[model samples]
Target: MNRDKVTEDRKKLGDFGEEMAKKYLINKGYTICHEKFRCPRGEIDLIAKNQDDLVFIEVKTRRSLRFGEPFESVDIRKQKKMIKLAQYYMNYYKISQVNVRFDVVSVLLDESWDVKEIKLIENAFY
Candidate 1:
Protein backbone atom coordinates (compact mmCIF):
# COMPACT_ATOMS: atom_id res chain seq x y z
CA MET A 1 0.00 0.00 0.00
CA ASN A 2 1.00 3.63 -0.42
CA ARG A 3 2.47 5.64 2.44
CA ASP A 4 -0.64 7.77 2.69
CA LYS A 5 -2.87 4.75 2.88
CA VAL A 6 -0.75 3.20 5.56
CA THR A 7 -0.83 6.37 7.63
CA GLU A 8 -4.57 6.65 7.25
CA ASP A 9 -5.07 3.06 8.31
CA ARG A 10 -2.93 3.55 11.37
CA LYS A 11 -4.95 6.59 12.35
CA LYS A 12 -8.18 4.70 11.93
CA LEU A 13 -6.86 1.92 14.11
CA GLY A 14 -5.83 4.43 16.73
CA ASP A 15 -9.26 6.04 16.74
CA PHE A 16 -10.94 2.71 17.13
CA GLY A 17 -8.63 1.79 19.99
CA GLU A 18 -9.30 5.06 21.73
CA GLU A 19 -13.03 4.52 21.51
CA MET A 20 -12.61 1.09 22.99
CA ALA A 21 -10.43 2.47 25.73
CA LYS A 22 -12.99 5.12 26.55
CA LYS A 23 -15.74 2.58 26.89
CA TYR A 24 -13.57 0.38 29.04
CA LEU A 25 -12.76 3.25 31.37
CA ILE A 26 -16.38 4.20 31.65
CA ASN A 27 -17.28 0.68 32.59
CA LYS A 28 -14.64 0.78 35.27
CA GLY A 29 -16.31 3.80 36.85
CA TYR A 30 -14.00 6.43 35.50
CA THR A 31 -15.54 9.69 34.45
CA ILE A 32 -14.08 10.69 31.13
CA CYS A 33 -13.17 14.34 31.21
CA HIS A 34 -11.74 14.79 27.74
CA GLU A 35 -10.77 13.06 24.54
CA LYS A 36 -7.97 13.94 22.15
CA PHE A 37 -6.82 16.80 24.34
CA ARG A 38 -4.20 18.75 22.39
CA CYS A 39 -1.91 21.60 23.08
CA PRO A 40 0.76 23.33 21.01
CA ARG A 41 3.18 20.73 22.29
CA GLY A 42 1.24 17.48 21.84
CA GLU A 43 -1.92 15.51 22.43
CA ILE A 44 -3.24 13.01 24.99
CA ASP A 45 -5.72 10.30 24.00
CA LEU A 46 -7.96 10.55 27.01
CA ILE A 47 -8.29 12.24 30.40
CA ALA A 48 -10.47 10.97 33.19
CA LYS A 49 -11.35 11.35 36.82
CA ASN A 50 -11.32 8.46 39.23
CA GLN A 51 -12.62 9.62 42.54
CA ASP A 52 -10.32 12.36 43.81
CA ASP A 53 -7.54 11.78 41.34
CA LEU A 54 -7.29 13.10 37.82
CA VAL A 55 -6.02 10.61 35.31
CA PHE A 56 -4.12 11.16 32.09
CA ILE A 57 -4.31 8.21 29.76
CA GLU A 58 -2.44 6.98 26.72
CA VAL A 59 -4.06 4.39 24.49
CA LYS A 60 -1.85 2.10 22.44
CA THR A 61 -3.37 -0.32 19.99
CA ARG A 62 -1.98 -3.10 17.83
CA ARG A 63 -3.39 -5.69 15.46
CA SER A 64 -0.64 -8.16 16.21
CA LEU A 65 2.20 -8.66 18.62
CA ARG A 66 4.74 -8.72 15.81
CA PHE A 67 6.60 -5.87 17.45
CA GLY A 68 5.46 -6.15 21.06
CA GLU A 69 2.53 -5.59 23.33
CA PRO A 70 0.82 -2.26 22.71
CA PHE A 71 1.90 -0.79 26.05
CA GLU A 72 5.52 -1.56 25.24
CA SER A 73 5.50 1.36 22.86
CA VAL A 74 5.18 3.81 25.76
CA ASP A 75 8.87 4.23 26.20
CA ILE A 76 10.73 6.85 28.20
CA ARG A 77 10.49 9.41 25.44
CA LYS A 78 6.76 8.89 25.12
CA GLN A 79 6.32 9.05 28.87
CA LYS A 80 8.11 12.36 28.99
CA LYS A 81 5.91 13.71 26.26
CA MET A 82 2.82 12.53 28.13
CA ILE A 83 3.99 14.28 31.27
CA LYS A 84 4.45 17.52 29.41
CA LEU A 85 1.01 17.29 27.88
CA ALA A 86 -0.55 16.50 31.24
CA GLN A 87 1.13 19.49 32.81
CA TYR A 88 0.00 21.68 29.98
CA TYR A 89 -3.56 20.47 30.35
CA MET A 90 -3.70 21.02 34.10
CA ASN A 91 -2.17 24.45 33.81
CA TYR A 92 -4.37 25.44 30.92
CA TYR A 93 -7.47 24.53 32.83
CA LYS A 94 -6.22 26.05 36.08
CA ILE A 95 -6.49 22.71 37.76
CA SER A 96 -4.47 22.32 40.91
CA GLN A 97 -4.31 20.71 44.33
CA VAL A 98 -5.46 17.37 43.01
CA ASN A 99 -3.65 14.08 42.71
CA VAL A 100 -2.75 13.19 39.15
CA ARG A 101 -1.85 9.85 37.65
CA PHE A 102 -0.89 8.49 34.28
CA ASP A 103 -2.44 5.38 32.85
CA VAL A 104 -1.94 3.28 29.76
CA VAL A 105 -4.70 1.34 28.04
CA SER A 106 -3.52 -1.25 25.59
CA VAL A 107 -5.93 -2.58 23.00
CA LEU A 108 -5.40 -5.61 20.87
CA LEU A 109 -7.53 -6.02 17.77
CA ASP A 110 -8.01 -9.12 15.68
CA GLU A 111 -7.57 -9.34 11.91
CA SER A 112 -11.21 -8.44 11.37
CA TRP A 113 -10.84 -5.26 13.50
CA ASP A 114 -12.63 -6.79 16.45
CA VAL A 115 -11.28 -6.17 19.89
CA LYS A 116 -9.37 -9.10 21.26
CA GLU A 117 -8.30 -7.71 24.61
CA ILE A 118 -8.03 -4.50 26.57
CA LYS A 119 -5.58 -4.03 29.41
CA LEU A 120 -5.38 -1.11 31.76
CA ILE A 121 -2.22 -0.16 33.58
CA GLU A 122 -2.77 2.48 36.17
CA ASN A 123 -0.01 4.68 37.52
CA ALA A 124 2.05 3.70 34.53
CA PHE A 125 4.46 6.55 35.09
CA TYR A 126 5.04 9.57 37.20
Candidate 2:
Protein backbone atom coordinates (compact mmCIF):
# COMPACT_ATOMS: atom_id res chain seq x y z
CA MET A 1 0.00 0.00 0.00
CA ASN A 2 1.01 3.60 -0.41
CA ARG A 3 1.94 5.89 2.47
CA ASP A 4 -1.38 7.68 2.43
CA LYS A 5 -3.32 4.45 2.40
CA VAL A 6 -1.26 3.14 5.27
CA THR A 7 -1.98 6.21 7.34
CA GLU A 8 -5.65 6.06 6.52
CA ASP A 9 -5.85 2.44 7.50
CA ARG A 10 -4.15 3.21 10.79
CA LYS A 11 -6.65 5.93 11.54
CA LYS A 12 -9.53 3.61 10.74
CA LEU A 13 -8.11 0.94 13.02
CA GLY A 14 -7.77 3.47 15.81
CA ASP A 15 -11.36 4.54 15.39
CA PHE A 16 -12.50 0.95 15.52
CA GLY A 17 -10.51 0.31 18.68
CA GLU A 18 -11.91 3.43 20.28
CA GLU A 19 -15.43 2.35 19.49
CA MET A 20 -14.78 -1.02 21.03
CA ALA A 21 -13.20 0.63 24.04
CA LYS A 22 -16.23 2.83 24.57
CA LYS A 23 -18.54 -0.15 24.51
CA TYR A 24 -16.25 -1.99 26.88
CA LEU A 25 -16.38 0.92 29.31
CA ILE A 26 -20.14 1.17 29.09
CA ASN A 27 -20.42 -2.54 29.71
CA LYS A 28 -18.39 -2.01 32.86
CA GLY A 29 -20.69 0.74 34.18
CA TYR A 30 -18.98 3.83 32.84
CA THR A 31 -20.86 6.66 31.23
CA ILE A 32 -19.13 7.90 28.12
CA CYS A 33 -18.53 11.60 28.50
CA HIS A 34 -16.40 12.29 25.46
CA GLU A 35 -14.58 10.71 22.59
CA LYS A 36 -11.43 12.07 20.97
CA PHE A 37 -11.45 15.12 23.18
CA ARG A 38 -8.75 17.43 21.92
CA CYS A 39 -7.21 20.78 22.72
CA PRO A 40 -3.95 22.62 22.14
CA ARG A 41 -2.11 20.19 24.35
CA GLY A 42 -3.18 16.79 23.08
CA GLU A 43 -6.03 14.41 22.47
CA ILE A 44 -7.70 12.07 24.93
CA ASP A 45 -9.31 8.98 23.50
CA LEU A 46 -12.13 8.73 25.98
CA ILE A 47 -13.41 10.54 29.05
CA ALA A 48 -15.81 8.69 31.28
CA LYS A 49 -17.45 8.81 34.66
CA ASN A 50 -17.82 5.82 36.90
CA GLN A 51 -19.52 6.30 40.23
CA ASP A 52 -17.90 9.42 41.74
CA ASP A 53 -14.63 9.31 39.91
CA LEU A 54 -13.65 10.69 36.54
CA VAL A 55 -11.68 8.41 34.30
CA PHE A 56 -9.25 9.41 31.60
CA ILE A 57 -8.78 6.64 29.12
CA GLU A 58 -6.03 6.20 26.56
CA VAL A 59 -6.61 3.54 23.99
CA LYS A 60 -3.89 1.72 22.11
CA THR A 61 -4.85 -0.64 19.38
CA ARG A 62 -2.86 -3.06 17.26
CA ARG A 63 -3.68 -5.55 14.55
CA SER A 64 -0.62 -7.48 15.69
CA LEU A 65 2.12 -7.04 18.28
CA ARG A 66 5.07 -7.45 16.01
CA PHE A 67 6.59 -4.27 17.40
CA GLY A 68 5.47 -4.45 21.02
CA GLU A 69 2.52 -4.85 23.29
CA PRO A 70 -0.33 -2.53 22.41
CA PHE A 71 -0.16 -0.72 25.74
CA GLU A 72 3.62 -0.55 25.72
CA SER A 73 3.47 2.41 23.37
CA VAL A 74 2.34 4.76 26.12
CA ASP A 75 5.85 5.85 26.98
CA ILE A 76 6.80 8.50 29.50
CA ARG A 77 6.36 11.31 27.00
CA LYS A 78 2.97 10.06 25.99
CA GLN A 79 1.99 9.70 29.64
CA LYS A 80 2.95 13.28 30.28
CA LYS A 81 0.92 14.42 27.29
CA MET A 82 -2.11 12.53 28.54
CA ILE A 83 -1.74 14.08 31.96
CA LYS A 84 -1.80 17.52 30.42
CA LEU A 85 -4.84 16.56 28.38
CA ALA A 86 -6.65 15.22 31.43
CA GLN A 87 -5.87 18.30 33.43
CA TYR A 88 -7.03 20.53 30.64
CA TYR A 89 -10.22 18.55 30.26
CA MET A 90 -11.04 18.76 33.95
CA ASN A 91 -10.28 22.44 34.16
CA TYR A 92 -12.19 23.24 31.01
CA TYR A 93 -15.29 21.54 32.36
CA LYS A 94 -14.74 22.79 35.92
CA ILE A 95 -14.73 19.23 37.17
CA SER A 96 -13.56 19.06 40.74
CA GLN A 97 -14.29 17.59 44.11
CA VAL A 98 -13.99 14.13 42.66
CA ASN A 99 -11.27 11.57 42.22
CA VAL A 100 -9.48 11.25 38.87
CA ARG A 101 -7.69 8.25 37.45
CA PHE A 102 -5.92 7.42 34.23
CA ASP A 103 -6.87 4.22 32.55
CA VAL A 104 -5.49 2.40 29.52
CA VAL A 105 -7.31 0.10 27.15
CA SER A 106 -5.19 -2.13 24.98
CA VAL A 107 -7.03 -3.68 22.09
CA LEU A 108 -5.74 -6.32 19.75
CA LEU A 109 -7.55 -7.25 16.58
CA ASP A 110 -7.53 -10.53 14.76
CA GLU A 111 -7.15 -10.98 11.00
CA SER A 112 -10.87 -10.68 10.49
CA TRP A 113 -11.04 -7.37 12.39
CA ASP A 114 -12.60 -9.06 15.40
CA VAL A 115 -11.44 -8.13 18.85
CA LYS A 116 -8.75 -10.51 19.96
CA GLU A 117 -7.84 -9.12 23.37
CA ILE A 118 -9.09 -6.18 25.32
CA LYS A 119 -7.24 -5.34 28.51
CA LEU A 120 -8.36 -2.58 30.79
CA ILE A 121 -5.82 -1.21 33.21
CA GLU A 122 -7.34 0.99 35.85
CA ASN A 123 -5.13 3.67 37.33
CA ALA A 124 -2.49 2.95 34.78
CA PHE A 125 -1.07 6.37 35.45
CA TYR A 126 -1.60 9.17 37.88
Candidate 3:
Protein backbone atom coordinates (compact mmCIF):
# COMPACT_ATOMS: atom_id res chain seq x y z
CA MET A 1 0.00 0.00 0.00
CA ASN A 2 2.72 2.43 0.98
CA ARG A 3 5.35 3.48 -1.54
CA ASP A 4 8.19 1.48 0.02
CA LYS A 5 5.99 -1.57 0.35
CA VAL A 6 4.92 -1.27 -3.24
CA THR A 7 8.51 -1.03 -4.37
CA GLU A 8 9.47 -4.08 -2.32
CA ASP A 9 6.54 -6.06 -3.70
CA ARG A 10 7.49 -5.19 -7.24
CA LYS A 11 11.09 -6.21 -6.63
CA LYS A 12 9.98 -9.58 -5.29
CA LEU A 13 7.69 -10.12 -8.24
CA GLY A 14 10.50 -9.26 -10.63
CA ASP A 15 12.82 -11.72 -8.90
CA PHE A 16 10.27 -14.46 -9.16
CA GLY A 17 9.75 -13.74 -12.83
CA GLU A 18 13.49 -13.83 -13.43
CA GLU A 19 13.76 -17.23 -11.80
CA MET A 20 10.99 -18.54 -14.00
CA ALA A 21 12.69 -17.06 -17.04
CA LYS A 22 15.95 -18.75 -16.14
CA LYS A 23 14.27 -22.11 -15.81
CA TYR A 24 12.45 -21.60 -19.07
CA LEU A 25 15.70 -20.82 -20.83
CA ILE A 26 17.32 -23.89 -19.33
CA ASN A 27 14.47 -26.02 -20.58
CA LYS A 28 14.98 -24.51 -24.01
CA GLY A 29 18.66 -25.65 -23.95
CA TYR A 30 20.22 -22.39 -22.83
CA THR A 31 22.89 -22.41 -20.19
CA ILE A 32 22.49 -19.49 -17.86
CA CYS A 33 25.80 -17.74 -17.44
CA HIS A 34 24.83 -15.20 -14.85
CA GLU A 35 21.93 -13.57 -13.05
CA LYS A 36 21.88 -9.89 -12.30
CA PHE A 37 25.14 -9.20 -14.01
CA ARG A 38 26.17 -5.69 -13.17
CA CYS A 39 28.59 -3.12 -14.44
CA PRO A 40 29.23 0.51 -13.67
CA ARG A 41 26.82 1.46 -16.41
CA GLY A 42 23.91 -0.87 -15.66
CA GLU A 43 22.70 -4.36 -14.91
CA ILE A 44 21.62 -7.22 -17.09
CA ASP A 45 18.93 -9.51 -15.75
CA LEU A 46 20.16 -12.61 -17.45
CA ILE A 47 23.11 -13.72 -19.55
CA ALA A 48 22.83 -17.06 -21.24
CA LYS A 49 24.55 -19.13 -23.84
CA ASN A 50 22.85 -21.27 -26.43
CA GLN A 51 25.60 -23.21 -28.10
CA ASP A 52 28.08 -20.60 -29.26
CA ASP A 53 25.76 -17.63 -29.09
CA LEU A 54 25.59 -15.36 -26.09
CA VAL A 55 22.17 -13.98 -25.20
CA PHE A 56 21.61 -10.84 -23.20
CA ILE A 57 18.08 -10.94 -21.84
CA GLU A 58 16.08 -8.24 -20.15
CA VAL A 59 13.24 -9.54 -18.03
CA LYS A 60 10.28 -7.27 -17.44
CA THR A 61 7.64 -8.36 -14.97
CA ARG A 62 4.35 -6.76 -14.07
CA ARG A 63 1.18 -7.66 -12.24
CA SER A 64 -0.87 -6.61 -15.25
CA LEU A 65 -0.61 -4.76 -18.54
CA ARG A 66 -3.19 -2.10 -17.89
CA PHE A 67 -0.82 0.72 -18.73
CA GLY A 68 1.40 -1.06 -21.19
CA GLU A 69 3.05 -4.39 -21.87
CA PRO A 70 6.04 -5.34 -19.76
CA PHE A 71 8.42 -5.40 -22.70
CA GLU A 72 7.39 -1.87 -23.57
CA SER A 73 9.11 -0.70 -20.42
CA VAL A 74 12.51 -1.24 -22.00
CA ASP A 75 13.26 2.00 -23.73
CA ILE A 76 16.13 3.00 -25.97
CA ARG A 77 18.32 4.31 -23.15
CA LYS A 78 17.94 1.06 -21.25
CA GLN A 79 18.85 -0.90 -24.35
CA LYS A 80 22.00 1.15 -24.82
CA LYS A 81 23.02 0.62 -21.22
CA MET A 82 22.43 -3.08 -21.48
CA ILE A 83 24.49 -3.23 -24.62
CA LYS A 84 27.33 -1.44 -22.89
CA LEU A 85 27.15 -3.82 -19.98
CA ALA A 86 27.12 -6.78 -22.33
CA GLN A 87 30.22 -5.49 -24.03
CA TYR A 88 31.92 -5.10 -20.71
CA TYR A 89 30.94 -8.64 -19.75
CA MET A 90 32.29 -9.99 -23.00
CA ASN A 91 35.62 -8.25 -22.51
CA TYR A 92 35.86 -9.35 -18.92
CA TYR A 93 35.25 -12.95 -19.86
CA LYS A 94 37.60 -12.71 -22.83
CA ILE A 95 34.99 -14.36 -24.96
CA SER A 96 35.54 -13.90 -28.63
CA GLN A 97 34.18 -15.56 -31.77
CA VAL A 98 30.74 -15.90 -30.26
CA ASN A 99 27.52 -14.52 -31.63
CA VAL A 100 25.56 -12.09 -29.48
CA ARG A 101 21.93 -11.04 -29.34
CA PHE A 102 19.50 -9.08 -27.24
CA ASP A 103 16.27 -10.56 -26.01
CA VAL A 104 13.33 -9.50 -23.88
CA VAL A 105 11.15 -11.66 -21.68
CA SER A 106 7.87 -10.18 -20.61
CA VAL A 107 6.28 -11.85 -17.61
CA LEU A 108 2.76 -11.31 -16.39
CA LEU A 109 1.87 -12.53 -12.92
CA ASP A 110 -1.42 -12.96 -11.13
CA GLU A 111 -2.34 -12.28 -7.54
CA SER A 112 -1.31 -15.77 -6.48
CA TRP A 113 2.15 -15.44 -8.04
CA ASP A 114 1.06 -17.61 -10.91
CA VAL A 115 2.50 -16.75 -14.28
CA LYS A 116 -0.27 -15.74 -16.60
CA GLU A 117 1.87 -15.03 -19.63
CA ILE A 118 5.51 -15.24 -20.64
CA LYS A 119 6.50 -13.64 -23.90
CA LEU A 120 9.96 -14.26 -25.29
CA ILE A 121 11.28 -11.79 -27.81
CA GLU A 122 14.43 -13.04 -29.49
CA ASN A 123 16.72 -10.58 -31.18
CA ALA A 124 14.49 -7.86 -29.86
CA PHE A 125 17.04 -5.13 -30.36
CA TYR A 126 20.47 -4.42 -31.70
Candidate 4:
Protein backbone atom coordinates (compact mmCIF):
# COMPACT_ATOMS: atom_id res chain seq x y z
CA MET A 1 0.00 0.00 0.00
CA ASN A 2 1.09 3.61 -0.55
CA ARG A 3 1.88 5.93 2.32
CA ASP A 4 -1.35 7.88 1.99
CA LYS A 5 -3.49 4.76 1.83
CA VAL A 6 -1.69 3.34 4.83
CA THR A 7 -2.36 6.50 6.83
CA GLU A 8 -5.99 6.55 5.85
CA ASP A 9 -6.47 2.91 6.77
CA ARG A 10 -4.78 3.45 10.07
CA LYS A 11 -7.09 6.33 10.87
CA LYS A 12 -10.09 4.24 9.93
CA LEU A 13 -8.91 1.50 12.24
CA GLY A 14 -8.51 3.99 15.07
CA ASP A 15 -12.01 5.34 14.53
CA PHE A 16 -13.43 1.84 14.54
CA GLY A 17 -11.53 0.97 17.68
CA GLU A 18 -12.75 4.09 19.47
CA GLU A 19 -16.35 3.39 18.54
CA MET A 20 -16.00 -0.16 19.79
CA ALA A 21 -14.46 1.06 23.01
CA LYS A 22 -17.33 3.49 23.58
CA LYS A 23 -19.89 0.76 23.05
CA TYR A 24 -18.06 -1.59 25.38
CA LEU A 25 -17.99 1.02 28.12
CA ILE A 26 -21.67 1.77 27.67
CA ASN A 27 -22.52 -1.91 27.95
CA LYS A 28 -20.55 -1.95 31.21
CA GLY A 29 -22.83 0.88 32.49
CA TYR A 30 -20.76 3.94 31.70
CA THR A 31 -22.37 7.12 30.43
CA ILE A 32 -20.36 8.59 27.58
CA CYS A 33 -19.37 12.16 28.30
CA HIS A 34 -16.97 12.82 25.45
CA GLU A 35 -15.17 11.22 22.57
CA LYS A 36 -11.95 12.60 21.15
CA PHE A 37 -11.93 15.39 23.68
CA ARG A 38 -9.10 17.68 22.71
CA CYS A 39 -7.53 21.00 23.67
CA PRO A 40 -4.16 22.69 23.67
CA ARG A 41 -2.95 20.41 26.46
CA GLY A 42 -3.70 17.05 24.86
CA GLU A 43 -6.36 14.68 23.61
CA ILE A 44 -8.53 12.37 25.67
CA ASP A 45 -9.77 9.28 23.87
CA LEU A 46 -12.91 8.95 25.88
CA ILE A 47 -14.38 10.46 29.03
CA ALA A 48 -17.35 8.90 30.76
CA LYS A 49 -19.21 8.44 34.00
CA ASN A 50 -18.62 5.06 35.54
CA GLN A 51 -21.32 5.08 38.14
CA ASP A 52 -20.48 8.03 40.39
CA ASP A 53 -16.90 8.56 39.32
CA LEU A 54 -15.62 10.39 36.28
CA VAL A 55 -13.46 8.11 34.15
CA PHE A 56 -10.81 9.22 31.71
CA ILE A 57 -9.89 6.50 29.26
CA GLU A 58 -7.06 5.88 26.84
CA VAL A 59 -7.95 3.45 24.14
CA LYS A 60 -5.07 1.74 22.35
CA THR A 61 -5.62 -0.60 19.46
CA ARG A 62 -3.38 -2.78 17.30
CA ARG A 63 -3.80 -5.40 14.65
CA SER A 64 -0.59 -7.05 15.73
CA LEU A 65 1.39 -6.99 18.97
CA ARG A 66 4.88 -7.49 17.62
CA PHE A 67 6.03 -4.47 19.61
CA GLY A 68 4.08 -5.24 22.76
CA GLU A 69 0.60 -5.20 24.24
CA PRO A 70 -1.46 -2.22 23.12
CA PHE A 71 -1.65 -0.70 26.61
CA GLU A 72 2.11 -0.88 26.91
CA SER A 73 2.33 2.10 24.59
CA VAL A 74 1.05 4.55 27.21
CA ASP A 75 4.50 5.56 28.35
CA ILE A 76 5.34 8.06 31.07
CA ARG A 77 5.27 11.06 28.76
CA LYS A 78 1.86 10.16 27.42
CA GLN A 79 0.59 9.50 30.90
CA LYS A 80 1.75 12.92 32.02
CA LYS A 81 0.00 14.56 29.09
CA MET A 82 -3.16 12.65 29.79
CA ILE A 83 -2.98 13.70 33.42
CA LYS A 84 -2.69 17.32 32.44
CA LEU A 85 -5.57 16.99 30.01
CA ALA A 86 -7.71 15.36 32.69
CA GLN A 87 -7.04 18.22 35.07
CA TYR A 88 -7.90 20.71 32.37
CA TYR A 89 -11.13 18.86 31.66
CA MET A 90 -12.11 18.91 35.31
CA ASN A 91 -11.34 22.58 35.72
CA TYR A 92 -13.04 23.48 32.48
CA TYR A 93 -16.19 21.75 33.63
CA LYS A 94 -15.92 23.06 37.20
CA ILE A 95 -16.05 19.56 38.52
CA SER A 96 -15.32 19.43 42.22
CA GLN A 97 -15.51 16.81 44.94
CA VAL A 98 -16.14 14.10 42.39
CA ASN A 99 -14.17 10.88 42.24
CA VAL A 100 -12.00 10.66 39.15
CA ARG A 101 -9.90 7.89 37.67
CA PHE A 102 -7.86 6.95 34.62
CA ASP A 103 -8.34 3.79 32.65
CA VAL A 104 -6.83 2.01 29.65
CA VAL A 105 -8.82 -0.01 27.18
CA SER A 106 -6.57 -2.16 25.00
CA VAL A 107 -8.04 -3.29 21.73
CA LEU A 108 -6.60 -6.17 19.73
CA LEU A 109 -7.69 -6.77 16.20
CA ASP A 110 -7.27 -9.46 13.60
CA GLU A 111 -5.84 -9.09 10.11
CA SER A 112 -9.32 -8.34 8.85
CA TRP A 113 -9.67 -5.55 11.42
CA ASP A 114 -12.20 -7.46 13.46
CA VAL A 115 -11.89 -6.97 17.21
CA LYS A 116 -10.24 -9.98 18.82
CA GLU A 117 -9.84 -8.74 22.36
CA ILE A 118 -10.78 -5.86 24.63
CA LYS A 119 -9.14 -5.42 28.00
CA LEU A 120 -10.15 -2.72 30.44
CA ILE A 121 -7.58 -1.72 33.01
CA GLU A 122 -9.29 0.28 35.73
CA ASN A 123 -7.37 2.72 37.87
CA ALA A 124 -4.56 2.48 35.38
CA PHE A 125 -2.93 5.61 36.69
CA TYR A 126 -3.31 8.18 39.43
- Give candidates' CA RMSD values in order: 0.5, 0.9, 1.2, 1.1
Residue-level lDDT of model 2, residues 3-121, one tens digit each, is 99999999999999999999999999999999999899879999999888899999999989998889999999999999888889888999888899999999999988999999999
User: What TM-score goes with each of the models?
Assistant: 0.99, 0.96, 0.93, 0.94
Instruction: Judging by lDDT against the true structure, name the best candidate.
Output: 1
lDDT tens readout by residue for model 3, 1-126: 899999998799889999988888899899998999987877899999887789999999888789699999999989998889998999989988889999999999887889999899999999
Pairs of colliding residues, candidate 2: none
Worst 10 residues of 2 by lDDT: 89-98
Q: Could you give candidate 1's per-residue lDDT for residues 20-61 as a string of tens digits? A: 999999999999999999889999999999998999999999
After superposing all C-alphas onto the true structure, candidate 4 shows an RMSD in angstroms of: 1.1
Residue 93 Cα positional deviation in candidate 1, in Å, after optimal superposition: 0.5
Who wins the TM-score comparison?
1
**lDDT (0 to 1) per candidate:** 0.97, 0.93, 0.91, 0.93
The TM-score obtained by model 3 is: 0.93
* Model 4's TM-score against the true structure: 0.94
Query: Which one wins by TM-score: 1 or 2?
Result: 1
How well is each residue in 1-126 modelled by candidate 4, as lDDT tens digits?
Answer: 899999998888888989999999999999999999999987899999998899999999999999899999999998899989999999999998999999999999999888999999999988
